[model samples]
Target: MKTAEGLKDIIKPENLVYRKSSLITDKPFSYCPGCGHGTTHRIIAEVIEEENLAENTIGVCPVGCSVLMYDFLDLDIQQAAHGRAPAVATAIKRLMPEKFVFTYQGDGDLAAIGTSETIHACNRGENILIVFINNGIYGMTGGQMAPTTLEGMKSSTSPYGRDVKMMGNPLKMTELVAMLPGTCYVTRQSVHTPAAVRKAKKAIKKAVGYQKKGMGTCFIEIVSNCPSGWKMTPVESNKWMEENMFAYYKPGDLKVPAESDADAENKNEQ
Candidate 1:
């Protein structure tokens, strides 16, 4: 009886503004400290939960940090070979068209090795969501340079900074895929700040909604920061990303159904 009336204002509604999504498991994330993969995982899980897709949502993960999504989200997920997530996702979605299928891939897995699978999926208009995390460097494999690595950027493989003359230019894979007619929506976002996180969540939810309507491939690129790989603090990595990555990638919708692209952009503003 001592605790019956002891918590009058201790647990008010105001004190519980934000709580963890139910879709996330109790298992701790394995990403490095300050890794964007954790935030991205939370956002995707939140969207799937909010959309009531928790049961039918299936994730096709690749051979990178992105594969950890299975441990975080409480959904049916399958792993794919290096750069073959799209192909796997295609099969999953085709076999169960009623289910929402998505592919979680990193820059190295999607842009470099799985480039063909990703392109063909977009070109063929696979009705699936593609969450592409671009941290520039390959975080899982000892911080090597990735296809989306910035020009003149340094990595374990590029000790003296990326030499564009020798290595060509950093690939703008998002824009390249957006150019395909099969793609329905393509947006680049980040999760560094609260506002950016909100935008990314909206982008994810929209992609899920579109897929439910049997829409074409929806690609959402998250331009993220890699503190460990970039050799900077989390805050510094975010600052550097805004200064360098955003300048080249430019966060926004790269493509949409021409008739509805303008409308979609306007809604995002509202």
Candidate 2:
């Protein structure tokens, strides 16, 4: 409870240990108090700096919660139409192959309207990183059931919970995208806990590194918590996600390098 001048001595330059990412500007985040967007943003920024890709990195975002993500990142961000980010990213990456291109999209944006775009781009082997945040509902556009909405999960539109027989099954886009021959690496991660945060960051770093190496497309799905949309407190949302979301989505590597690379590494070790 001290003024700026009063705390100077106690908070000396050496006393400062950790700081926010420089890529994060003074612009305040518009995400809800406990939304995962901020944490995901910070993780991406740190990896961009750690991998020395901040300057050359280009980000594409489309309609939905991810549309505003550009406000938090300091890199060059392109705004695409609803479900059109993959097309924009494909163009950007193809024209300037040297630049590190990535897209930040939500389940509503990627799995719902942009499913075709996402599939075609990945199938073409576009060397870009796709950061997909699946909270299972449309957070920005009311709490409607999204493509990833779990079975029996209630939403504004699905007031009685999603019924498999009536609404069809929740789309597992990550697993579907993983089977594409163009995809080089695929992982499902979460940022709800400290340990999970570390793993998400590592996954991001690897995805970016893979792009730099011209490895095919990389898709990272973050099964995040949406407290407001889920009608739960931030803490409750985290717990709910762990219990329900993780059970269905299940965080882990969905796909990785082929056996050829493993054999080559084994020979090198020998």
- The best candidate by TM-score is 1
| C-alpha lDDT values of all predictions | 0.90, 0.90
Give lDDT tens digits, candidate 1, residues 1-270.
557566765578787878879999999999888888999999988888888888898899999987777888889999999999999999999999999999999999999999999999999999999999999989998899987888899999999999999987999999999999889999999999999999999899888778877879999999999999999999999999999999999999887666775476568658
lDDT of 2 by residue, 180-213 (tens): 9999989999999999999999888778767877
Clash count, candidate 2:
0
Show pairs that collide, candidate 2.
none
TM-score for candidate 2, please give it: 0.92
Segments in model 1 whose C-alpha atoms lie over 4 Å from true places: 1-10, 13-15, 260-270
Poorest lDDT segment (10 consecutive residues) of candidate 2: 261-270
CA displacement after TM-score superposition, residue 182 of candidate 1 (Å): 0.4
